[model samples]
Target: MAKASVNSPSGPASVETLTTRGRKTRDALLDAARTVFEDVGFPEARVELITAAAQVSYGTFYRYFESKEDVFRVLSDQLFEDIHHRGPSDSTLSPAQRLIAANRTYYQAYRRNARLMAIVEQVATFNDDFRRLRHDHRHQLIDRQARAIARWQQEGLVRQSLDPEMAARAMSAMVDHTLYLWLVQGDEANEALLLDTLDQMCLGALGLDQD
Candidate 1:
């Protein structure tokens, strides 16, 4: 029902056009669902509320998602996809450089989806469905980063003693906690504070000397 525009070309124009349209529809529905969920929470965010907000009918909603949990799963997966490309693609930048890029993307995504993050955090605490859904996505992201951290350690970009799994978990915790605090409390999620905090934690965990 709504159109989303793609300005910069990343691939063939025709394919990009199709992708832009599909992405827009999904994003619109997700955004609307998040808003309804934030206002009414997981238990009360009915399909009607979401469909109404998205200006779509119940049939349209089902065409895109089977259930509310399905949408929530999509939301978490989309968040991870937004953060990392999850491929062994080449990057001209070093590992640390790429990590910084990923961190920035994560924070920006958190800011943009603050309401949804809040809803997910609350639902995750007591709801097994939400918890399992969120946990699965998080585990995948952590594992991927762990592999990258292992590579960085082998290259001496990180300290030899830093356990990649532990480092990945710590990084995930930091991002989650930071976002939760900002979103739940309406506090300013300062970029500098986030960067400084993450940098310090990473440096300490990796046993790197203070720069």
Candidate 2:
């Protein structure tokens, strides 16, 4: 099994050193923190409330997390990881089809986690640490996509004239900003139609329409 861990202000130095029981307590706090953050938003959230929600004592909470923000940061890290997640490759699909599939996956994930994402956006406004974290994560996603675009160029799918790095950054930003408007800004859209339009835009950029 593959596991992913993140390093952040809220993350532990290492979780692998913890006992199984300690890990369970840490996970429970994180799960409870997610509910509380969504219910009350990050700024208004309290460690007491989280401990109450988790059915754990204050001492138990402190044993795992230093403060409410600590738990909240961990929760945000997990959600961000989920947002950046990639599904297994489908070799049968064309490059265009693969791009469509990846976009759909991202859109649906954003929709599911929209409220939390909105809160993250709000918090990042005044929180330099969080803003930096979000920027780093965004670039990481762009870099991943850029590598894919470079491969398509090598395979003679995308135009060799296009710079994969710049194209990937632009394309990822297009999707991110579009979805942020639709999801966080409460813009109404038909999902199927929106995805179709996005597919057309992406395919056109890749010159898949010419092929």
Candidate 3:
């Protein structure tokens, strides 16, 4: 037998190729995990199922992540990042206008990703990692809304009795409940109807005459 050359590109090429393949394999595993989580939910979902679905080996899974929850955290962060991809903007518009813009953006997003949103909410209810993310995001959103409410208060547009923090949380709750009802009821409440109803509710809460 001819002496094998240790310095040949063939030997090095095999290692380089495997390294590249490993990255592709990791991405595929994450993608498969997201799909499985969406279908079966986080609590009921299993790593073996995700790896099997991706056709990746158990050892490969360990090389990428410590546990299924690690993958879940990545997915949760990506989901929020996608939701905020539009970017948040501060407005010089009136308080009510700001409210409408914010509410409309949320409504549009919910309509586009109702299933994903529902799954995220369900998962957050049970998963501590997801729950922390959910709470953190909600706090950020409410803080932004509270600042908007404060602006209106400074302008004397809204009643002084209106508490910005409380108002923001109330508005968030209203939007959440409305979305839940719409999702569970199958179009029983249309967007236009929801907008009108929310407008009325918000105006009443803010002590503003409908304009």
Q: After superposition, how far is residue 178 of candidate 1 from its true place, in Å?
A: 1.9
Question: Each candidate's TM vs. the true structure?
Answer: 0.72, 0.86, 0.74
Candidate 1 per-residue lDDT, tens place, 1-211, comes to 1112222333112324446666677668888987787788777878789989998766666655656777776776666566544435447865655666676667677777677677777878987877887788789889988998898778777877778999899878987786677666766867688677876676567654543
RMSD each, Å: 8.4, 5.6, 9.3
Which candidate wins on TM-score?
A: 2
Query: What is the model-wide C-alpha lDDT for candidate 3?
Result: 0.72
Query: What digit string (tens of lDDT, one per residue) describes model 2 on residues 99-190?
Result: 88888888888888888898888888988878887888888898998899899888888888888889888888788888999888978999
Candidate 1 residue runs with Cα over 4 Å from true position: 1-31, 58-60, 85-90, 188-190, 208-211
Winner by TM-score between candidate 3 and candidate 2: 2
Q: Each model's C-alpha lDDT?
A: 0.70, 0.80, 0.72
Residue 54 local lDDT, model 2: 87
| Model 1 residue 19 distance off true place after TM-score fit, in angstroms | 14
TM-score of 3: 0.74
Model 3 pairs whose backbones collide = none
58: Cα error in model 1, Å = 4.1
The alpha-carbon lDDT assigned to residue 169 of candidate 2 equals 81
lDDT of 2 at 66: 62
